[model samples]
Target chain A: MPLLDVDYMLGLVPILLRYLPLTLQMAAVGMALALVLACGLAVIRVLRIPGLNAATLLFISFFRGTPLLVQLFLFYYGLPQLLAFLTQINGITATIMGLTLHFSAYMAESIRAAIVGVDRSQTEAALSIGMTNGQLMRRIVLPQATRVAVPTLMNYFIDMIKATSLAFTLGVTELMGATQKEAAGSFLYFEAFITVAIFYWLIVELLAWVQRRLETRLNEAYRR
Target chain B: MIKVEGLIKRFGGQAVLDGIDLAIEQGEIVVIIGPSGTGKSTLLRCLNFLERPDAGRLTIGDLNVDVTRATRADILTARRRTAFVFQNYALFANKTALQNIAEGLIVVNRWPKERAHARAREILERIGLADKADAYPASLSGGQQQRVGIGRAMAAQAEVILFDEPTSSLDPEWVEEVLGLMKRLAAERQTMLVVTHEMSFARDVADRVIFMEGGRIVEQGPPDQLFRAPQDPRTRDFLRQVLATQVALDVPD
Candidate 1:
């Protein structure tokens, strides 16, 4: 009856924490898959490899223009209708598919920009020293581009962690779904949601700490 | 030995290097001095096919390529036999000095990593940057970075080194060290073709000095004759203007 149930919020923390792994698992797997796909798309975009380049651009536009929640529904509901095999995929698989497709589009553009941002002189220097084009990219260009892309890529990863909360909409019992179930049974909606928010906040805070360490390590070469 | 014949390069339909003909014997130091935009840098860049001369022939050691018709293999072979130094050091930002020096050795020459690193260490010591081997380009002084750039060139053991205004971007304080390194390299009878505005370096280090104008070699001779008594009117006028500016800069305010 009170304005807030502090003790109940405290008690729900353990219950909500139980679902943290599911949330993390979704984010980790989705991000890993997205990063790999994004790198491929970025390389295609950078090279402008004939037919594949135009297709990559259209794919990026479609994924980026649509809402993530709508994309999730399409993957879960719409994909099964077109592809018979997809009908067997559970809610978790569909949610992951949605996340991977959505995030990779954004990541592809950022990675391409980072690669283009590398100094032209670096390429010239590599070529002058007898490096093949492939060697130039692998040894000189990408290493420098990695320095430029790390912060942006880490931002996308954090965005990915929060984006996983939307997985519950697909009927996947991730963090948000678990909270919804508990809230419905007890009718302590605010308390349950607040506990879930704290879990997400803690995870993001831990990740931010890791990102700082990674940035410091990458920036070591540039330090005066 | 290196030879370039009828090296022609055009930008926007205007010739930058118009039918250049040059040859250098092994261990000869040839210095090119000309007014800006006269194609001194372009000629050097064309030797390694960096600009892909419109029509020319380049022969270094036993390798020869027609610039207009050179294949990828020809360009790679040409580059392998020659090294270049830029006005801006252009050291790999992500690599340490040692790694930059060793990169060509391992990647281009296909030497084992340990052998490359060992050679890199000797080059670093020779360049007086032994203690900074682990330091990245960003942390080194401009002089030190350019030394590492030169070390990278040295580690290649190319038949000839092309220097394109190597000290032009340096702070005045840093210029002397780079030029001194070049002097030492020249003293060792290394084959080098240098384009620079440093009259003193040309006079002191170059075995032969070439004067270019309008994308052609207007005159060439020993540095004593070229600097002190240039025969061509264009060369004389260009040298007078450059020397006047040099004297003006040297005068205390």
Candidate 2:
């Protein structure tokens, strides 16, 4: 193998950093959308609201069971051919939609597990205290469930940041897309790809560090 | 005041609460005692519609609680009148003790946050947990958590509070702390329907003692009358067995 090119890798840093904002925006937008969808799906499954619950379960199962790459292609490529409306959507929007759907399925399962993890007795206690179903979920159940979900949700976010790399396949000029262009022009695939890998690793590490800090803070009151 | 008539509950094929009838006067403290699995807890849960009775007529101070017959809104209104404390001290684990106590007041009563927090603090102090107000349920000992549970119930200011084996899960040494708080609450003339295994506390704190067996009320009377001289054979046998076990455990080798 060619001697590890430190100078070349160092030079690629500024180039990759230019696309960092785009990468962060995709992850942030995807996460916000996924959170909204996940909360709805989780509540449906947790409460088992008849037809809605069945639909949510199917949504979760279908998305989670299939590979995310296929889902991305289906949204970016397959859907536009099938429907004219989707053809009007841009690559960035399609990438975000794909990321949101894929992440929301995993997030729904995580959130449902967290919600179910709360003791049944707490719900009963809330009800006996005269809380309506809405009040119980809003004031009691979700507050507790969100605490339990923080770590898992952060894990999903970290996974989401890595998953954004696949958006390059849709021709969205995110960090990975920028890296591929830079590598193709410069003919330094190894150096360019390694720089992007390092960037992703650093962000994931930062998120993992924040996750640990959050977990400790949330659990601090309970610890002696 | 409450009236329960023809209360029946079944889990699958097993009858948990066979048709039972009882009347509780306003400001009365009624202690229901029976062997485990005799549906004592079930009966208390039924009062708040936590475990809806399969067949029954429940009237809490003139409001009917047979959910099947009552409108959804009406049932909710009736449930607000009665608060329940569980064996496990079901304080929301993620919430501070104060938040747990203030939640019902804020959500159900629409009390402002400041007023709710103030009232919650007062109740926590009354329950001897003022210093632990900001602590989470997981931070407190079992006894402290149960006290917080009592405080949560008191904060709701419901007309009646139901306790289902409140101290049964406490450490033996710490049981009295919870029972003591309960005794004080009973003395304050809080309308309490308590299901407990602590015969001593029942005898001391209850206005009336009820013995349940096979899901039916077999006997009831003043605590002194029931404990000193139970009329039914089942009650006598139960008291005898409970006392004999305590005695055997206490006696030296």
Candidate 3:
């Protein structure tokens, strides 16, 4: 056999592309779940809700400091034994849950900083205008903070799509899982991995383009 | 009428405002002039419970709140009767100049969006910023932004408007524009408590003037009396120190 199998790599591309949807699904669902949870966690962290901030801090520290691979294995293998209801969790569900939990910890910090970055004067101005607390948060504060958070959130989303490759560890046949089988059948490891890498690169480029446009729109008001 | 009594605020154990008491009649324009750190701004803030006085009583129109025992409802009710203009032109930076003025109406007054925008546009015209309706605060000059800020307070239409050094942050070229707007509001007999350093504006526009020092009202009287024949030694010293500059402006080179 030749040292390099160019034909095998080209053939692996279609097979891996078939698995791209599954990988995209894991990332999209996990990111949607993480976004909601992160926003709540960020608000709680920003407000310093009495008696809960310590718990939140410890939770963030644990998730942020630990390796995601370790967390994924723990959630996929160790969790079902600890919780009876978790026994029904499948490989895909476990992988998504792991991704959501891990990514939310990181995103929460970015969101908290974005919220706190909103100027105090904005709060005072909204309140002085007789806006209720709800109105102030929904209308004045969040919109401004969201603009500041968009680039970071997009970075997290792109990170997540790549992270879904780890789902193979949980037995989910996403892009990486399919690539592993193709590599085994043909013993063309380099070709299999390159095919998957190209797919990821394309996805990242698409998302980065959207991020650039969004940043431009967000900055339009302040632009001279 | 707006009645404030026994207001006190402590910061790191020192009282910023100690035992402030004053009354302003309906449509009265009271200008508060004092040295920095003397609590003139703090007193105006206490009226709207912005600084949350450690102990005080504030009555704005029919709403009353005791600082020590006030409920959340009581606080909001008191806040609704009053409005504030900030020293640094705290317009909503994310919004267009017109939206900044309309925010209060849409949120607090529950006006329909179209109606609030219509009213905001009229206020923009009234403030001589009709062309800036669609411009965000960052795009506007300091004078244009400050005028939009004043229009926000005007749209609030509260029984009393508390100004916290509204013109102190402006460039010298822009100060006259903001002060001229306030002078017009004064002529309309809007109830206002203005904390400012523009002594000429105080001398010319105030219905009553209050001099504060060391967090106490040293003296208060009609502008003519407070400016020309202040009774308290602190008041006389303050006016002399501040107006010595005005005296120079009055005399042509």
Model 1 alpha-carbon drift over 4 Å, by segment: A1-7, B247-253
TM-scores of all predicted structures: 0.95, 0.94, 0.96
C-alpha-based local distance difference test score of model 3:
0.88
Clashing pairs in 1: none
Q: True interface contacts reproduced by each model, as a fraction?
A: 0.81, 0.77, 0.55
The whole-model lDDT of each prediction reads 0.91, 0.87, 0.88
Model 2 docking grade: medium
Regions of model 3 farther than 4 Å from truth: A1-10, B248-253
Tens-digit per-residue lDDT, A18-103, candidate 2: 88998899899999999999999998888799999999989988999999899989988899899989888777787788889999
lDDT of 1 at A140: 93
Question: Who wins the DockQ comparison?
Answer: 1
Q: For candidate 2, give the DockQ.
A: 0.67
State each model's C-alpha RMSD to the native: 2.8, 3.0, 2.3
Q: What class would a CAPRI assessor give candidate 1's docking?
A: medium
For candidate 3, give the lDDT of residue A211. Answer: 97
Report the TM-score of chain B alone for all candidates: 0.96, 0.94, 0.95
Better of 1 and 3 by lDDT: 1
What is the per-residue lDDT of model 2 for residues B1-253, given as tens digits with 9 covering 90 to 100? 7888999999997889999999988899999998989999999888788876788888887687664576677667778888889999988876899999998889899999999999998998899888998888888999999999999889877778989999888899889899989889988999999998888888778999999999999999998888887889999888888867553222111
